[model samples]
Target: MTEPPFELEPIGEVRTPFETSDEAPRQGLEGEEPTHGEIVLAPAFEPGLEGIEDGETVDVLWIADEADRSVLRVRDGERGVFSTRSPHRPNPICVTTCRVRAVDGRRLAVSGVDMLDGSPVVDLKAPLE
Candidate 1:
């Protein structure tokens, strides 16, 4: 038997103008309107972000709370959650590339975002890699 993947908790929430997926941009990298959001890292994980803003862009890891995560067949029905950009799916976790636009104290100002309002932010790292 194989061990299942470990559970992950959200470190913070992603703030955006979008309250629903119907309004969220399809691709986060395609937008460059200088949108900014906060990455309130969990107080316990604050140390992990030390010296993280050394680049102009970064990768944001988050959970897709809106994903359906029920159906398995993806050939039909809007290509199912797996094939569709819809965040509702079996693996709700998602990552997007965002410009670091600016870094202020324990919060980060990011651009090129496509996430929903109050979405959980799991992790962030410089996109230099």
Candidate 2:
């Protein structure tokens, strides 16, 4: 079978200490779970991040941007593709959430990151009511 084609235009890049996926936590934006990473949004999104505030965490949807998409099944092999935090085998796409640490004009300093360095950010939104 022939794989279909797809295209992706990176909106911006993220910076974090997670140099390798092996070091990355099992969960994205573990929040209070104990992680020391941040997300730096592009300057163009400053106006959009106006609503975010300190302690007001928002979900940062990002692309793994560095993971391989050939492996599936959980480590214990006890769950289906639609169950649990098994994004390790996503369809070449990855998403994560981060807490809005601080917003300085167009620069967003956030924590609770689980993505690799220089990852691609797709979308971000404050938690819905």
Candidate 3:
């Protein structure tokens, strides 16, 4: 049976130089420079940013809304969405583990970002070692 659809409110949004998925690095580690991006948190979520420090690594959960959710197969049509890192999938949820560079109130400067510009940030968590 199919599950009921649900909605999620974004606590923040991603800001990056990449304007299109084609231009973004396939992975955050692909390049030294392309790994840079920022997390712009909403004012209401500002207080929640209290303990996040500059030197810590965090898991950034975002919504890749621009990606084609209808795509189930990719890479020569052999790999299923669940087996590949392709952003196109049944659900366009994307996650990136990144090191914090700086934090200014509700904005966080991070390194190792692979998601597109304006991607909605659903949540942030400490990355497991």
Off by more than 4 A, model 1: 1-5, 74-85
Mind giving the per-residue lDDT tens digits that candidate 1 earns over 43-108?
Answer: 777677677663477788889886767856565664646566556667877778887765665677
lDDT of 3 at 122: 94
Local error of candidate 3 at residue 61 (angstroms): 0.6
**Which model scores highest in lDDT?**
3
Please state the error at residue 94 of candidate 2 in Å.
Answer: 3.2
TM-score of every candidate relative to the true structure: 0.80, 0.74, 0.90
Residue 92 C-alpha lDDT in model 3:
84
- Write the residue-wise lDDT of candidate 3 on 17-97 in tens digits: 889878788778557664789999999999988899998988999998878889988988888889987788888888888
- Clash number for candidate 2: 0
Candidates in order have lDDT scores of 0.73, 0.68, 0.87
C-alpha RMSD by candidate, in order: 3.0, 4.0, 2.5
Displacement of the residue 14 alpha carbon in candidate 2, Å: 2.0
Tell how far residue 97 is off in model 2, in angstroms. Answer: 2.9
Candidate scoring better on TM-score of 2 and 3:
3
lDDT of 2 by residue, 27-118 (tens): 65544465655566667766777667887777777777555566566667666545655555655465566666777775577777777888
RMSD of 2: 4.0
Q: lDDT of candidate 2?
A: 0.68
